[model samples]
Target: MSTAVGGTTRPCPECGARVPVDERFTVWCAACDWNVDPGERQEHRQKQETEKRRAKRPGQGRLEEARRALARRHGERLHTEMTRDGADLRARRDGASVLAYALALAVHGVTAALLAGGVLCLVWGWGGGLMLLGAVLLVMAVALRPRLSPPLGDGTVLRRADAPELYALVDEVARAVGTRGVDTISVGKEINASVISRGLRGRRALDLGLPLWEVLTPQQRVALLGHELGHYANGDTRHGRVVGSALRSLATWRYYFLPTPRPSLGEMIVNAVYAVPLLLVQGTLSLLDHLTLRATQRAEYLADREAARTASTEAAAGLMDQMLVLDSIDVFLRRESNNAALAGARSARRNAAGAREGGDLWTRLAAHLASVPEHEYERQRRAGARRGHSVDSTHPPTHLRRAFLLTGPPAEPAVVLDEAKQRRIAAELATARAEVARSIVRDGVA
Candidate 1:
C-alpha cells in the first residue's frame, strides 16, 4: 500500500511507479521508498486549501442580472441626476442631519446627570455607595469618547518635496474636481485609497496604497485621484468625520458598560446592571447609522460621476472594475503571502539560518495573477461577484456603477497624460511599492 499527498498523483521519481493521491499531506511511494519533505507536503496542502476557499463565495448572478436590468431601464436618468445634482443634495441633507449630534449629547448629558445625582445623593445616609458607582460610570463615559482621528498604521507620508511630479498631477486633479488639495499624501501597504480627516480641524489626508497604484493604468490613476478629491469637493469627508466619530464613541461606550458575559460572577453582575441603559444608547445610534448608510452609498455614486467628469467615462468605469476585482484578490493574496512567509521564517529558525526567503512577496503574487489566463480570471471573478442590494454596504454595486458610466454623458476637456509623465509617475510609485513590500514582509515575520 502506498501513502499519498493531497494534490495530483504523479509517477514516483525513483522507480517510475504510480503514486496515489488522497487526503493525507505526505506522499510516499512504498514500492520505491519515495517521499516528499514535510515542508513541500505542507505547502502543497495549503495551496489546495487556499484555492478551494478563494473560489467559493456564494455567487451573485441573479442579483447582478437584476441590477443590469434596472440599469438598462433607468440608468440614463440616474446618471443625469448623479452628475448634475447628487453631490449637492447629499451634502445639504448630511449637513441637515445635525440631529446626529444628539447621539453624542445623549451620552455625555446622561453621564453628567448621573454624576450630579450622585453628588446630591451624598446628602443622605448610604449615599457613599451610590456615589462610588456614579464615579465609575462617569469615568467610563469619559474614556469612551472616540479618538478624533483614524489610525494611519505603517503609512509613509508622500510629501510634495518627495515627488513634485506626483503632487503636480494630484493638484491638477484637485483643480479639475473644484477642491482644495489634500494636506498630505501617504502611501500604505494595502490595496485601497481614500481621503481621511486628521482631527477635529478636519485636515484632509489622502492615502494611496502602493499595491493599487502599481496595477493601475494612467487614466485609472486620474480617475481614482478625482474620486477621492471629489469627497472633499462635495463635503463628504467633512460631514462623515462628525457622524462617524459619534458612531465610534457610542460603540466604545457600549463596550465598556455592556461587555459580553464573563465567567466571573462580579463582572457579570456589573454588566447586567449597566446593560439596560447602554441598550437605549446603542438603539439610538443604530438608527442614526441606518439613516447615514443610504447617504454614504449615494455619496460614492456621486463621487464616481465626479471622477467621470474630471477624467474620462472609460477611465472612471475602468477604475470601478479594478476596485471590484482588486478588493477580493488583495485579501486572498495577502493572506497567502503572509502564511507562506511565516512558514519560511519558522523553517529558517529550525535550520538556524538568520533569515528566510520569499522577499517581494506582493510583486511575486501580482506577477502570478497577471499571468493567469483570461478565461480563468473571468471564472474567478464570477465566483466572487457580490450580492446585490447589500443594505449595509457603503458603496453601490460595481456592475451598476459600470453600467451607469457607460450610459452617462461625456466629459469636456478630458484628462490625458503624456507618455513621459506617465513613465515618471510609474517610477515614483515603484519606490513606494518597494517601501510597502518591505513593511509587509517585516511585519509578517515579526
Candidate 2:
C-alpha cells in the first residue's frame, strides 16, 4: 500500500464489498468498513489469551477489570461534576486542587531536602563516604530540578513584525477567551499546536505544527487558538510548575532506578538494590497522576468550552472531528513518505543516487485529507467511541469531549476570521509551511 492510489479497485475480504483502493493505502471496505479497525476484530483472540493467562494466575483478569471499572466510575462522576459546573471555572476550586498543590510542594520539598542534605554531607559531615554520597545526591537533585527548557528555537520564532495578521488573529482569540495573547508565534514540524512559556518572566509562545495547522480551516484555526490560550486563562495544575515538575522529577527518578533486561550478576544485584526505590517513585508518580487526572481533564473541557464560545460550536466540533481522524492523517503521511522512498530507491538504482521529490508534501497532504470520504470519518468516529481514546492521554475521551460540546448551549463566533485576514495568515505561514513539508519528505515521519 506504498504506491499512489487511483490504479485499481478490489473486493473487501470481510464482506465481498467493492472498495476503491489501489496499492496506495489501507484497503478497507467502504461499504461494510471491513478492516477499518483490525484491532476491534481481535477481541475473541484477546479474550482467549486472557483466559489462558488467567488459568496460570487466578483472578488476574478480574483484578484488572475491577481496576478499570473503578477508574471508569471515577471518570463518570468527574464528568457529571464538570457538567454541573458548566463552563464556569471560577468557583471550581475544591479539595482535589488543594491536595494536588500540597503534594506538589512536598515533591519540591524532597528536592530541596536533597540539596540541603547534600551540602550538609559535603561540608559538615567529615568522611569520604559522606562526600561521595553528597556528590551523588547533588547530581540527582540537579537532574530533578524544575526548569523550562524552551520548546521553541530561535530560527522557528515567527515575529509579530513578520506575521501581524496571524498575531492579530491570535490576540483577538485571546480576548474572546478572556486572556492576553501570547508573546510570539512559531511554526514547527509537529502535527500539533501548543502554548508554552519560557524564562523567569514566563513569556508565552504559541507554537503551531504546520501539518496540523494547514489541515485546519480558518475558523477551526480560531478554535485551536481559543483552546491553547484558554489554558493560560484557566490555570492548569498539571501544567503548573509545582505539580508538573513533581511529575517530571518522579519520572526522572523512575528512569534512574529502572530494571534492565538481560542483567549481569552485578547488574542483577544492583537492580535488587534499586527495586524498592523504583517501586516507590513509580507509586508516587501514579498517585500524582491520579490526583491530577480530573483537574487536567477539566482543564481540557474548559479549553474546549472556550473554543466553542470563541469560534462557534460548529467550528469547535469541526476541530474535534479533525482530532478524531488524526490517525488516518498520520497513516496517509507515512504512506506518502514510504512511496517517496520507494520511488527514490528505484531511481537510485538507475541514476546511482536516490532523489526524493519535495516541496509538494503539503499539497499532497491537503489533497489526501480532502479526498477522505465522509464515511471514513464516520468510521473513525465510531472507532474512537469504541476505543475511548483522546488526542492526549491527559485529556478526556474524544467522544465525551464531543458530547460535552454538542450537549451544551451553542455560541456564535465571537472572534471571526474574514476571508481577507485568512489569506494574510496563510501568506505569513507560507514559507514555514514549505520548509516543514520539505523536511517531512527528506527525513520522513517517525
Candidate 3:
C-alpha cells in the first residue's frame, strides 16, 4: 500500500528505520517525535521544482507568483480594517461610561449643596422656607431611596441554570459581547423590572417581576432583560446609587429639624424653632430628587439602546408594546380598587358620624382635621393618611416610561433576529404561560 505525507517523498530523516518514501515527509517524525516545518519544506520543494522548470519557461512562473503576493496583501488589509473598527466601538463605549459618571456626580453634588443652603436660609426665617422645605423633602425621598435586592447564588453558570429562559437569553447575549452576567433575577407581583447597583465596588443586580413574565413574550422578555443589563454594563448602577445616597442624607438632615406632632409642649416649641431651616432643607432635597429622576430618564434611554444592541430592534419594540399593555391593565385594576375602597370609606364614615360628633373640643378638632383634604395636608399627615399611596411614590410614571421606550432614539448597534428564532420564542412564551397557570391552579387547590 502507498502512504503519503506533506505532498513529498523522501527517506526518514529522524531515524535509520526504513519507511515509505511519502511518509518520510511527515510534519512530525513518527520514530523520534521531532517537529518538521511543513510550510518551509513545501516552499523549498516548490522552489526546487520551479528552478528545474524555469530552464524551460522562466517568464510563465512570474505571473503566478505575483498573483499569490497580491492575495496575501489583500487579506492583510481586510484584517487591519476589522481591527480598526473594533477599536472604534470600544472607544465609544468607554466615552459613554465616563459621561454617565460625570453627570451622576454633578447632579448629586449640586442637589446636596442646594439642600444645605436652603436649610440654612430657612433657619434665618427666609420667606421661601415652606416651598424650600417641600422641594427638599421631595429630593430626599428620591435620593434616600432603598432598592430591594435580588437573591442570587455564588456560581454564574449555576445561577443561570435556575433562571427562566429569558434570563438565559440575557446571559448568552452578555457573554457573547464579553460583558458580565446579570447579577440577579427577582420575581415580583408587579409588571416591572429594574437594575440596581450599590457601593464603590459596583455590585449590581436585576429585579424582574413575575407579573412581567405573564405579560411579555419571550423575545420581549429578552429585550427587557437586555435593557436592564445594559444599565449595569454601562456602569450606571454604582454611580446612580452614590448620587441617591448623597441626596438622601441631605434630605434626612432637613427632615430631622422639622416639627412633628408630640404629646409634650416643650418638644413642639423646640421643633418650631428649627422649622425654617427644616423647610429650606426640604426644598433642597426636592430639587435633588427632580434632578435624580431626570438622570434616571436619561439612563433609561441609554439602557434601551443597549437592549437593542444585545437583542434585536424588534425585540426592543416588543418590550415596549408589552409594557404599555401591562400598564393599561394595572391602571384599570388600580382604578377599580380605589373606587371600591372609597365606597367602603364612605360607609365607614357614615357609621362613625354619630360617635365622632359627640366629643370634647380637642377631640372634635382632631376629627375635623382628619377630614381635611390629604393633598393640602402636611407631609406627615399625608403619609399617615395612606389615601392612595401609589400616586405619591417615586419612580417614573408607567405611561411615560412605556412611551419613551417605544419611541426613543436608536443609540447603540442594531441587532438582527430571524423568523425561525421569533417562532421559537413564541412557542417558549406559550409554554411559560401554561406553566404559570398550572402553578396558580395547584396553589389554589392546595
Top candidate, metric TM-score: 2
Off by over 4 Å in 2: 1-37, 80-91, 126-129, 150-155, 346-357, 389-392
For lDDT, the strongest prediction is 2
lDDT (Cα, tens digit) per residue for candidate 3, span 1-446: 23445233334567744333332123343354333334455767988898778779977578656644553443334223323423322212234345544554654655556666556656654566565775675576455433323234221121444545545565676664446765554443344666565445545566555446545555566677677776656544333565555554554566567677763888878887888878766766555554444334345555665676666556776565454344344543343334434544665553343233222312332233333322222222222222211221332333333334445344343333346665654354443333332322222111
Q: Of the candidates numbered 2 and 3, which has the greater TM-score value?
A: 2
**lDDT tens string, model 1, 1-446?**
44445335667779988866543224546465455333445757865775566567434544544555654434334445655533344444554255555555565565567556655555442545766665665565467655568777567887777777888888899898888777788888667888877797878788887667766678888899998888777756324665667776677766766666554888788777888978877797677765565556566776787788888888888777676556445654556556655555675452222123224555565674454333333332342232344434566667666666666366643567678998887677666766566555545311
Per-candidate TM vs. native? 0.67, 0.85, 0.43
Q: lDDT per prediction?
A: 0.63, 0.76, 0.47
Number of backbone collisions per candidate: 0, 0, 14
Question: Candidate 2: which pairs clash?
Answer: none
Off by over 4 Å in 3: 1-161, 164-167, 175-179, 235-239, 251-258, 262-264, 290-294, 331-446
Residues 397-424, model 2: lDDT tens digits: 7767777888757889999899999988
Q: Using alpha carbons, what is the TM-score of model 2?
A: 0.85
